[model samples]
Target: MHNDTGELVAALDIGGTKIAGALVDGAGRLLARARRATPADGDAATVMGAVAEVLGELLADGRRPRVRAVGIGSAGPVNAAEGTVSPVNVPGWRGFPLVAEVGRLTAGLPVVLVGDGVAMTAAEHWQGAARGRANALCLVVSTGVGGGLVLSGRLHPGPTGNAGHIGHISVDLDGDLCPCGARGCVERIASGPNIARRALETGWRPGPDGDASAAAVAAAARAGDRAALASFARAAQALAAGIAATATLVEIEVAVIGGGVAGAGEVLFAPLRERLRDYATLSFASGVEVLPARLGSDAGLVGAAAAAADACGLWETAGPGGRRH
Candidate 1:
């Protein structure tokens, strides 16, 4: 691929619940945006249709100029080399040809693919929380826990584009059997659904709206419900363990966290900070700092653009040196 083309690129963020698209310029500012709900439960074609709709909206908009390439950050197991994806939450997309499909939709524009976590990391490292940090971990803690790593000042997307998948890392080896066929993974204990599940199982009921989500659980905890508090505490504890493990293994200087569950504010972070003291023991892991993500909901699309920039060589404005695991 040619390096840093200095042109506009189409960016897509595909998740189980939503597909967001945008046109981002050379400097990373979004020029146009579009979105569609993902038909995750539908057949493969149906899901593709939703993505097509998103692309149609962006491409059809008269205000935006034609983009030079397309970048997709998808819920994965994504194979960047093969240009395929198999997201766990979206069952219909096993080995889906996302890159080719998206390329065709955009009139054969060059397409780039990366795991959603890697996309987020790219965004963070480019202009968000991890911008100046040489080593960092960026995490999304919504429906599932996803993560990516930055090492020596560049995003590190390992072979097959799943290197920094911290969500599936086993923290509680003997704890619970996860859907990913792993036992005691960080996601099993720290994802939004898991948090709400633990709270509900512990006798915490939803309020008048009858919404039994992690937000509801957070609200209950804020209202001084002991069960809800306990649930978040447990999730925070697991997250702390996972963060410490990453720090110990890779020597990251910072951990940037984002997503729906992170919206719980201090209710989740307070305990998480407290618990980190217990797990980050080694001297090399002592200074690892945890911070809230700065990009908000736009991280995915922004990161998608950033990953595209990296893949197309548009993100090497600083210097030519880079690394990969």
Candidate 2:
């Protein structure tokens, strides 16, 4: 549906691999967009420069004037209250003031910040698989496993904006130590890189292309590679444990899985669904549904806009000079 409110928000999705920007409307449509490869090894300023470049593209668009606010979805842990982010994968961005910098770049527009997982949840709840669900968990299982919750039909980002970060929750006590100082965390097992690592350790060789990504492993799994299938199965078990734990704690109605690894289709979902039954045995949790994300690559950008629109009351209350009331 078209947004009759004429509300437009600029959105930024910052990850370890890329920086994406878009001008999104209230109806979850992208009016303009831009992206740049993240210089993951660069200093703080250099990383910020890439963000600036993406924003420059949006700013140059003819629709720029109608933009009412800015939204940022950055890899966590993010301090939404303080507008700072310390994403685990982006080492150079410890405690970076992303909101302030984006606000300055956007000429003082109101800027709202949320963890990338929270942003994805907002988008899913607004326009994707979780839209009609009153309680849900949305997960991104790519370079990392990030998640956010929606409860009572609203995004629940917690005080620090990292409420539903299930990636660090220990699923195995004796498992390998995660970078977050935890052992057997979901990300350590279920993340794409970890999936590839496990497949390689178990003697799953990549094809002639030498692409050892989780996608390649998934292809091998589809081709009946035992080692590749085992790796994905292990990842699925970890994911199922995490999802069941979350469902048991929150009574979520559904778990929406997304991101690069999720693109593996049945290679991930078939085992995930089967394993979920093993863990989610409680009556309430057993009824929980698992589904793939529908928003695809645009989820982060759309979610960032959804978060800003929700937080700033863009649809209902506008203060002087188009600022949120």
Go through the candidates in order and give the C-alpha RMSD of each one to the true structure. 3.0, 3.9
- Tell me how many clashing residue pairs each candidate has: 2, 0
lDDT for residue 115 in candidate 2, whole number 0-100: 90
The candidate that achieves the highest lDDT relative to the unseen native structure: 2
lDDT by residue for model 2 over 223-266, one digit each (tens)? 99999999999999999999999999999999999999999999
Q: lDDT by residue for model 1 over 1-325, one digit each (tens)?
A: 2245447778999988899999887667888888999898999999999999988888886633547778899998899989999988799999999999988887778898989998888888877888778889999999889999988877788877777889998999798999889899999999999999999999999988899999999999999999999999999999999999999999999999998999999999999999999999999997899899988888888888877777766545212235431
Which regions in candidate 2 have their CA more than 4 angstroms from the true location? 1-3, 316-325
- Please give the distance, in angstroms, between residue 309's alpha carbon in candidate 2 and its true position after superposition: 0.3
lDDT of 2 at 112: 88
Runs off by more than 4 Å, candidate 1: 1-6, 61-66, 316-325
Best by TM-score: 2
The alpha-carbon deviation from the true structure for residue 243 of candidate 1, after best TM-score superposition, in angstroms, is 0.6
What's the residue-level lDDT of 261 in candidate 2? 98
